[model samples]
Target: MGIGQGSATCGSRTTCGSLDVKLRLFSSIRKYYLFSKDTAQVAFFVRYMSSQGPKEELLGLLPLSGQTRGEDIANAVQKCLEDNKIDLNKIVSIATDGARSMTGKNKGATTILQSKINHEILTFHCIIHQEALCAQTFPAEIVEVMNLVIKIVNRILSKALYHR
Candidate 1:
């Protein structure tokens, strides 16, 4: 659903049954594209300002669908909130799996989030994503022969042997 509240509040669901937090379009890691230009990753983090807890609890998913641009991430976040009838002012901070497109120097999702939400929206880089980025930053060269050898080894192994 696009960013907007439904007539039924999230809290109402609790009284009716359970606190059903509607989720966004989900995808499995194995089904994800590793480095495809057609895809982008998007993530959002939320914390309730209410010390008493919230009508809807926040969620921090480890990996999000590929969302390459800041606008795309912002749109996804907004959409999620709207679908769940979450009050932006009630949000405290947001921790995300930092992607440059989402956390760039300016006009990034972090900065854009501040603009979109009157509440304090703090964007933090996830440790895991950061570590992965660090690992990718090192300058190294892999021998083509070595890569071919690994491919051959992979071909000999079962799919179960691949962790990801």
Candidate 2:
């Protein structure tokens, strides 16, 4: 699903159940067409569990200039929050990959954001990232097999040769 439009509470309890409800923020940096040049931009997203299961929305993309320090990520997130008018308090947690620029001890994006939002917002490394890390522990043979299978599947799908 998608995030509700307009100014609505992000993690409101749905009628489905009284289970834990939270708004999750996810982000990533990627190359995008800007000014006809390939540039790295950080794209932010918001996610939450709803009655229909889960929902997410693309917050915004910030141009990454020079080194992407901790403060840079914090500023990008703050600008996104301001532009979208999303209440900082409503953000129950932030999920990001375990990058030094994100979860560093002294100066990190999450730390900087906590200072700006004035709350110890719950944070964690992305589950997918954790799983990938775990996968690295598998034997090289298994990893190679998985990679080969992935490549074959990707090629088949890209060529529209896969039926069903």
Kindly list the per-residue Cα lDDT of model 1 for residues 70-104, writing each as its tens digit: 76676777767777787656655666666676677
Residue 143 deviation, candidate 2, in Å?
A: 1.7
**Lowest summed-lDDT stretch of 10 residues in model 2?**
21-30
The top-ranked prediction according to TM-score is: 2
Show where candidate 2 strays beyond 4 Å: 1-38, 49-53, 148-164
lDDT of each: 0.61, 0.78
Q: How high a TM-score does candidate 1 get?
A: 0.44
Q: What are the per-residue Cα lDDT tens digits for candidate 2 across 60-98?
A: 878877778888888888877887787776777889888
lDDT of 2 at 10: 36
